[model samples]
Target: MSPPYDLVCFDLDGTLVQGTVFIWQTLHDFFGTDGDRRRKAKDDFHAGRISYRQWFEHDLELLGEAGATRDLMLAAIAGVRPTPGGHQTLAVLREAGLGLAIISGSIDLVLHRHYGQVSFEEVLINHLSFDHRGALVGGTPTDFDVDRKGAGLLEIARRQQVDPKRVAFVGDNYNDVSAARAAGLAIAFNPRSEELVETADVVVEGDDLRGILPHLLDE
Candidate 1:
């Protein structure tokens, strides 16, 4: 069977990486675990109060105090091995000629590890600024991506020169659900929250993202 869509967009954490967001895990290592905040975010996510962007942006801001640099974030992400089937599943999608995109709320340094590994043709993540000498100043990113996730998907489709109707997006958060639903088809993978699961055309409960494979094809 042919693939159901021409493009595939994926969220990094929970969707592909699974469990903790890379940055947060590092922060927890540095500052010690704060289960209260985690519970609060999860509760809010389930209660339809805050978005994945808000939860992530808040967590990042909390971690900003740790004085983590672009280098440190990269190191942390390297520690976060992708879910069991992430890379293989990605290879399958790329082989199918699907325009791949990584539309994530995470920092650029963390997502950059995906280069030459995951099938994403282009990635859109929060960028960090540094001096000419390459030291992280720990300031806010000039162009935050949360507000632009959906537009990023559209931009990818435009750049790939594929019809918007031919694109599919998958994720596990409410923020991603909006953009995913806007795509030709949306697959929610092992969603921690119900809002996003409800938005998806297909919801896979298994941690193995490869479960998403069948949904991508038109038998």
Candidate 2:
């Protein structure tokens, strides 16, 4: 059978890595971001008192304060593991001749290194800034803002010369909902929240990433 979609986009964090967000989780492990300040920033962002840009900026600042240097981030990320069958799933998708893309709000260098073995034709993610000495400076502007991920996905399709209706986007969070819905097809992979379940066209639940493969092809 032909591939179900012209292009398929995957979210990098929980969807692929099967762990917490790379930057924050790394911060918690290497450069602690605990306490009231972190909570307030999160709450404010969810409440719209602060924008996603501000939330990320605040988080990066806190991380830098906690001594998050490039080397430290690389060390913290070294231990991260991909979701079960993540590599195999990508292989299968490629074998089936689907264009694959990564659309994420996570740090670019981190994801690039983590998933370096895998191949993605299009990658839309945020970049981290580092000083000459390799200390964390900040983050570069990114198109993967919360709720705007759909726009990024569409942009990928545009660049790939694929129709929007021929795209599939998979994610595991409420932040991924809008993007998934905007795509031609939406798959919620091991959804951790109710909002994600309701937002997706298909839901695949399992410790293994291969579970999504069956849903990607027409019967």
TM of each candidate vs. truth = 0.74, 0.90
* Least accurate 10 contiguous residues by lDDT in model 1: 138-147
> Judged by TM-score, which candidate is best?
2
Residue pairs with colliding backbones in model 1 are none
lDDT, candidate 1, 98-202, per-residue tens: 768888766566565654445457777666666675555544432324445677778888899988778888888766765765678888887766877777788
Q: Best by lDDT, which number?
A: 2
Show where candidate 1 strays beyond 4 Å: 21-29, 32-65, 74-79, 114-119, 129-134, 138-147
- Those runs of model 2 whose alpha carbons end farther than 4 Å from true positions after fitting are none
Question: In candidate 1, residue 109 scores what lDDT?
Answer: 61
TM-score of 1: 0.74
lDDT of 2 by residue, 1-219 (tens): 687688789988888786565456566667666657888998998899998888888888888888888888878777667888988888888888898899887778667676887779988888898999999898864767567898998889889999988998888877798788789989999887698799889999889988888777665
For model 1, what is the C-alpha lDDT against the true structure?
0.69
